[model samples]
Target chain A: MILIRVHKECKRFISKCLKHNINLITIKSDKDDLIVKIHDNDLEEIVRLNYYSQIEIIKYYGIKGVLLNLRKYFFDYIMLLIFLIALYFISNIIIKIDINHENTALKERVNGLLIEKGIEVFTYRKDITDLNEISNAIVEENKDFLDWMSINRVGMKYVVSFEERIINDISEESGNCHIVAKKDGVITKIVADHGVTLVEKGDYVREGDIIISGEITLNEEVKDTTCASGEVLGETWYKVNITVPFAYQDKKYSDKSRYNFYLNGNYFYKKNYDHYDEEVIFKLDIFGNNFKIVKQKEYELSDLQYTKEEARKIALEESSKRLLEKIGQNSTVLEQKVLKETVNNSTIEMEIFIVVEENIGTTRMFEVGEEIDTE
Target chain B: MLDIIKSYISNEKFYIIIMDSAIYIKNYSKIINIADDEIIIEISGTLYKIKGSSFSLTKSINRELEIKGYVESVDKL
Candidate 1:
């Protein structure tokens, strides 16, 4: 909008404009001038002619309105472009999934199980709504595998929890079962709940001895065939022999911090997959998740590896741990034999045989097809 | 030639005058520089650096005085 006035009260300019039949969308008049708001294209020639400079053309518009006119081009074009670019960077671009399970096999099984329910792997993008349905499907189909389940959506990630099904072998309904000695040993003690015991305290029994019987009889009549169930701590013996190479080389670089990101089931990393080296390997399972590191990282590797005397010592310690696991808890070591000993090229090798005393028992239950009536 | 040269030098204080055999300054010799007892004028660049007392003399030559300082160092910067 521009304000214009003529020096003389003549209508020379106005008359010419009227004769030319110019179209102005908005026009107003004040004490001595005409205020015309016209589009930029049409007002070019009018301003060029200088028809109003001879007279005083005062602007009465406020500063706010003047600034608004100046910002029309800047805000409508430049600022809008800048705002859209900022929005693109702040938006979420990746989707993450959190799997909660103690067993990798079961977790993978559940993932495969979810695929059966139409949940594709990194292909079809799904949100919490699909997550909820997948959870429901897992709960319905894997009743025997999972104890409980839950699905959650945290930001752009989908988390699923599959609680493990803990099956306790001992219960009141397991009366149709029998406990047998898993190793040849002398029974040190016995605790029974049902069925007849075939061995007594200080009684020597071999492997497969029925410590508690599942059959029952009274007055020459068939009464009950229940599981013989009880804990019978027996004095079991074992001989274990282990050998280690004297000259062995173990991997010194165990700082394997595998940072993995998956996009469409693809992996990227810098670890050399082709190099063969000396290393000791072991696996540690926390809850149901497996982490590979240090001495545990070298175990079960698809590459050739060896360990020196120091790592061999650690490997011996790990082997002792495995032996303890097989023997159950803390057991007494009766005798040890060093079958062979050798040393080579910064390596110490020895073959040692050991004897251990332990308690081994296994409970077997026979399920009855008929129900017992309690009167 | 002298009559013609004297007629052309009448209205100017400094003019080119051609005499019988040599050229001469009409009222004074061609002043290559303007100097005074307290100042010196050096025309080393496109313009003259009027130092000390010669500033007033150089100032008098306003329309003809050109300050030839480096344009890129000041104006363009």
Candidate 2:
């Protein structure tokens, strides 16, 4: 049917050409554009006489006159060709990767793992497949941390969502154990369940000291043993030693910089310079081919001297940061003070004291025939 | 029924079909008159005159033609 239509259109175009006294033969009609073979002699006459009907020779059998006619739209045709090629390359790549998770740490870990497996942003979609298999493999690899995981593709982006495994403390409930002090602290509160309270409130306890005993005595005789589970809130003190340097190095960048581009793992312009920082200005990756525009700026490091007051402030902040690292989460900072400060050569040294209210008890299991040590 | 049998027997000759606002003609000998509002076609020894508004010979080949427009009348002369 299409061939018949084309043949009919060709005949009609030829007949129209004859009626206009234009010596032309119809080659084909491409939708709206009618491609015709016209004699060189009649071309000028056709152009002058057929002002109402637009005609152009698309191709010539033996003459180069067609190139002159196409010269008007040569640049437009070239741009259209380039645009089509760019579109084809862009459509095959994954433009974005979105991990659906609330925890930033877990998202970063998953993103890193996906990148290792060759499924990342700007990667070709055709290169990654078997999403279910990959998801199962990832879950298996992180079996201790992840319970469920799934990867889905939406347009050019891969959406990853996962569930982390929550480990439950079942040993405390199952074994006969005593709650001992994890660290040396003064007991502020104590709650003992299914055991005897060894330490009362306001009592000072040492590390490894049992705050709650698992033994239950009846008629002043040992009768039963159970898991002693409770919260022993204590006032813990931490002493952190910190040193802050009086002189610190600051980076000073030069105003001069050079620009370069990299395409497909090869640099368009290459230069080697030490102590230079590269800032990426633009980046594009299509079908595994990467393009990057970068600015290289050179810099030097110089020491800047700080005053005594500034050094003390810096030392205090450093000490506080160190103290926080030692203290576990869910602990309340009750009070903090700089116990001692001394100025050394080119450095400020200080000792910090911090008091925190925290859970200072840990469960320890005992064998059936084991004797209890009271030390 | 007689016309159907006759058409089937003379199927190799010229065939003309008049549809809504379109005319399909096959085995046409020549185009007598071509214009924007009317067209005259010859098939064998007879001339078929097609009158319409804004008429156009949209498709034409050897011994075939497709006329498209707001067809007003078709007569055999």
Candidate 3:
């Protein structure tokens, strides 16, 4: 068998071989090559007699060029193996949605409602339309909610929004609760809308005095009774005390580093990779109109040096912040003093005492049986 | 087997032995650069060179040198 790349015209070569008394048993022609088979005895004579001019017959038939082809190689089939593996991995990675809400009972109710409408917590990734459908379903279900609120996840964080419900006012027929001044002070002002006020601006009201009355009397006969629900702005005096530490032995994370990954709210990390330089990643959560996102910053955490003055200042500021959150915002500091200081090995502990005057008066019903239920 | 070049140290000279081929150098000599196209060495206050497309030599910073064409062997004259 002979294989050669030629421009065409294999039949002319076979016909010429037959004319030379050579048995051209087989002939095959392709786009760029031709193959012919003959007896080796005829091939030897054809070369000796220089009768290989069958190529001239090909040339006469417009065959352009001819060349021999030697095919010998192995097969590994490696590229086809990699293509199948890539297709297997890509088909499994998908997105999943998880809802984390505070009210477990309400969440179960909502989950059941959504599942009835073909939206379940464990539903497949392809079934979700949008999260708004779930939120709208909740609002449609709870019509009596006075302060209905919802928090949803936008991408990776939760966004909370709420609507305040106003409670309807009851008519004033039976005797309602009357709010009175609890301290001895001069009434700066009074707002009496549903009830009758017995005192006005600049009126000196003693402790347990009735600034507004719940009963409306005419000609010494009971006409109606209403709730004395109004503010009595008074010049009230108070005394507050706070304590602080002058120094502290703080335990902080060293320059040791640990890399962690979290999935489904669980943290996972390798136990071996520990030694790192001075950088620590700090993440702070910030709220936006759509969702909440974490802002991460890399901080170089240095070893804490002993500083008594800085510790004292930090303690005082911390105590003041805690006090203000409990008291009203209008409260002003009247006095402050470092009452005590105790220095230990690595910590110089101190206490800061403070006093302030703030408004701290709120009213509750004093009835024996009527109590408002809260959930 | 003829392509394999093995190196060893003699009493006072370094010897390279291959199939039907041998080379010798003084004890103070060492192979400084060997490339696919050439082999260079410093021997006893003299320089010896051999040129051929023989083997691969890697330079610092990960560069390869390949010798091509005819091989010409030389010794210190």
Candidate 4:
């Protein structure tokens, strides 16, 4: 841009100047004249027109103007640009790792895993996908010890938090306790460790009857109370009544399956597997939009009918399963018999008697002098 | 063909407007004479005279010129 002074009367010369479509800006300088700013390219032609022989360019603007003013401070501008680039690189480098957990051993273990995955200090920050994968891998590797682990990035630092897994155990449980009969059964055996043996083998004990007492007895006087550490194996009986329909449908799953998803989850297009069960393998919600992946296991159905003998056999097996579920895995199904059976057109009902040998003992804590059974 | 030429001629007709202290001229092809108090410009085939005081003409897009001054008279010759 070019700025020039023009006499007021010659403003008509401005009109003559306009006849050529020259881009210019006019500012009223005083009562007698004005300053006209135009493109530098138009100055040569405007001067050639002979209307104004004295159009002096007072100052430059635009790129040309910037260059004219910045020529003296070029080095400073270059140094500033370099400083900004260095700041960008420094901001992205990981400087410190903060493991925010109470367990120092667990913290060190997690730090080792993180460093193994290139997540230590003074390294470039990993992308979001890599960080998420590393978190999942570490959690899966130590599933028994770690309940959940999360790694989050805050500026140039990595912040980690986790929870340790806790499990329940049965030893000398429920302090100051006695091993009582959990079921009304005949005592088949007794194994005592820390408590006074109350019932002998082959004794008929009722529910809530103590098999081993935590109180120490001395000449009809009580001494000290301790948790009973023993198990009482007994013979128990159960009469279970069951009814099952003779005609039933059985489902068998085939190996053919398909994956399905929408939204942020990975796109997968498999052939549609019809008549199937859908299991969601992965799911995450983002801003109320569901991203999901489903595994479809296709199943085929077959109709089956059981005869009277077959029904009886199945009923006995089911009865054993039901009994074990109640008495736990250490029980043995010693005997079974069907006492009554009633059948209709499509169903069979039966009352089955079953005998099981199981350890019928669970701890029940007691306070001092709570019926310590004097001999 | 004739309609297109006629339409072009009508569209190119010069127009002049006088308001307060300014005169606006459109489709002016040349400035035959100009001074502080008076200016003559050719519009189409006719010559138009603008008599005013302290005339300053500014040309913008669409061949439109704005002249600002004390307007006395405008005539076509």
Cα lDDT tens digits for candidate 4, A181-295:
8889999989998799989998998888888988888998887878887768999999999887888778899888877775554456655665788897765443345566777
**In model 2, what lDDT does residue B53 have?**
82
> How many clashes would you count in candidate 1?
23
Runs with alpha carbons beyond 4 Å of true place in candidate 4: A1-176, A219-225, A253-257, A262-274, A279-282, A327-330, A364-375, B1-77
Taking the tens digit of each residue's C-alpha lDDT, what string does model 2 give over A209-266? 9999887877867688888888899999988788888989888887768998988878
lDDT value, residue A251 of candidate 1: 39
Which pairs of residues clash in candidate 2, taking residues 3 or more apart in a chain or in different chains?
none
- In CAPRI terms, where does candidate 1 land? incorrect
| Candidate 3 lDDT over residue span B1-77, tens digit each | 42322333224343332222322232424455554466676656677676655432211111112222344566563
The Cα error of candidate 3 at residue A185, in Å, is 7.9
True contacts kept of each: 0.00, 0.00, 0.00, 0.08
Q: Cα lDDT for residue A62, model 3?
A: 16
Candidate 2, residues B18-66: lDDT per residue as tens digits? 7678677777777788777887888898998888886655555445666
| lDDT (10s digit) by residue, model 3, range A91-120 | 322223344556666555655554565443
Off by over 4 Å in 2: A1-72, A100-123, A129-141, A172-175, A189-197, A213-226, A249-303, A326-341, A351-357, A367-370, B1-77
At residue A312, give the lDDT of candidate 3.
65
Each prediction's total of clashing residue pairs, residues at least 3 apart in sequence or on different chains, is 23, 0, 5, 0
